[model samples]
Target: MKNTSAVILFAAMLASLVSCKTGGKALLPNVSGKAGEVAVVIDKENWEGSLGTEVKGLLARDCEYLPQREPLYSLVNVSPSAFADLFKYHRNIVMFNIAPDVEKQEIVYRTDVWAKTQCLIQINASCADSASVLLERNGENIAEAIEQAERNRVIINTLQYEETKLGDEIAKMIGGRIHIPVGYNFKKVTDNFIWIADEKQYSTQGIFVYRCPAEDEDPFTLEKIVARRNEVLKNNVPGMFENTYMTTSEYVVPGVRFLKYKGRDFVETRGLWEVKNDFMGGPFVSHSFYSKDGKEIIVLEAWVYAAKFDKRQFMRQTESFLYSFEWDKE
Candidate 1:
């Protein structure tokens, strides 16, 4: 009897240990340096088109432009939205490289832009020993050179800002502020998640909005989007819910059904879905929306699972989010 009791205790302890372990660790690919390189290529292409002759003229007037390997200004068409997408979705910095030569692999300029709009610049002359030596030996005024490069970046960013502001204004015209039903507050959580609620309002209606500018593709149509949402609901958690399409005067939205919670409506609408799978189990949501004017799309999405919590409580939370939904008026 003593031996049997000891054995049982050991088994219980082992089971407890196993239960405590958390699963779902993900190994993401390293794409850190790619954005900056991409940005440089884009900038070169754009400058080449817009002011290639003029810039070459300027370089000839100020700095030496060698036919063999000269540093000529050019611009590459980079989707502003794509740059934003990199920052918003990947949480990676978009860097610009202005290396003098392709073979050198030395970066002349490096800047990290958040949401493809905010910029942080870093330049190093040591990457290229030849260039560094030449600059140092000649005493070619490093401070002035660095200042000029930074000034160029400022000009680029200023142009980008003007474009973004215009886009925002257009978006506001399309989707006038929907107004978060009275009595709710926006609560921002760590790592970009937000909770929408009011003290008294119950019902799972909160919405989460994420900006992914790198996704420059056209927004998915209502039909295609609804289908994708249904696919997620069907495959991720089986037999617990059904998905259907809800049509409004302006748009068709996707909704999920809860078998556990009868007579509750769970609908979600967005212009784009920026899904991240390994973050909170699977298929975390990110969405964008455009105004009726068709200038900009506002995106709202959420990740809380109603299946994990009590049906009534989940419904209440959902309602609170939905009721609190609002859009910028201007």
Candidate 2:
């Protein structure tokens, strides 16, 4: 009887978490579709015109730092007339409403409109031209909203099956908190650095956690961040062969941007990684930000190595765990 009661309590707690995440009183159905995919709703007229062209160009652009060309999002265009209940449950959605009756262009970004963890972006415009203008003005924001939605799904799943031991280890190692998925195993742990990876037959998803003194005269620059990673990975992360190590790719310069995400300021860097004197390579992303006391720069980074497959989703999934980071202050 006690065991059954415990199980019932756990189920209730999980349901409550889902309720909080979806912001709905009633339980919402789990979102459908694959990661890094979006369903676009538009009429056939706009589908063949410049509006669809622009939307495709924005959402389906080539993902950065991959060995092969894979779109940031695999878009499945759905005609509004054919958009049924199934399509409404997609994880990411971009819908267009173009009508003469629309007095002003309005863009409504809603979550959980039709399904849990769904990102439904409704653009109401007077015409295709006006819709295009709205998209052009807010293209970056739109993409980010979809990206966050994708990450939220990953974070939710991670929380449900989190490895509490790894979370405890991270808290001890770096004075930080992050929800880790079950498949990951601790690769290395030290005072200044920690490495964990989820290894599989087709892909390798890895993460590194470390801290710097925040003492660099001018820290948080691309040059500084890249140089630091090269130094750290070279000594710590080795390759298949002797003297081979991981380093930032010299061929492709990294890009860095300042973001205030989830109520904290951090510098996000995106670039490719290559094995020194070897052929293996893939993409990497990291977030660098100051600790609570402002004395140390806590850096959380994730990398993907999938030579046999397209790596956009792998990279996103690995890095999205970092987005679940929170301050586990003592």
> Superposing all C-alpha atoms, what RMSD in Å does each candidate have to the true structure?
26.3, 9.8
All candidates: TM-score: 0.23, 0.91
| Model 2 bad stretches (over 4 Å) | 1-25
Candidate 2 per-residue C-alpha lDDT over 1-330 given as tens digits, one digit per residue, 9 for 90 to 100 = 533443344345336445566676256777788899899988777888999999999999988777688898999998765565458678898887676666779888888765778898878787889999999999999999999999999999999999989888888866777899899999998888899999999889998998878888778999999988899899889989999999999888999999998699999999999999999889999999988888888889999999888888899999999999988756
- For candidate 2, the 10 contiguous residues with the lowest summed lDDT are 2-11
User: Residue 59 lDDT in model 1?
Assistant: 25
lDDT of 1 at 309: 33
**Quick one: best TM-score, which candidate?**
2
In model 1, what lDDT does residue 210 have? Answer: 29
Instruction: Assess each prediction's global lDDT (C-alpha) against the native.
Output: 0.32, 0.85
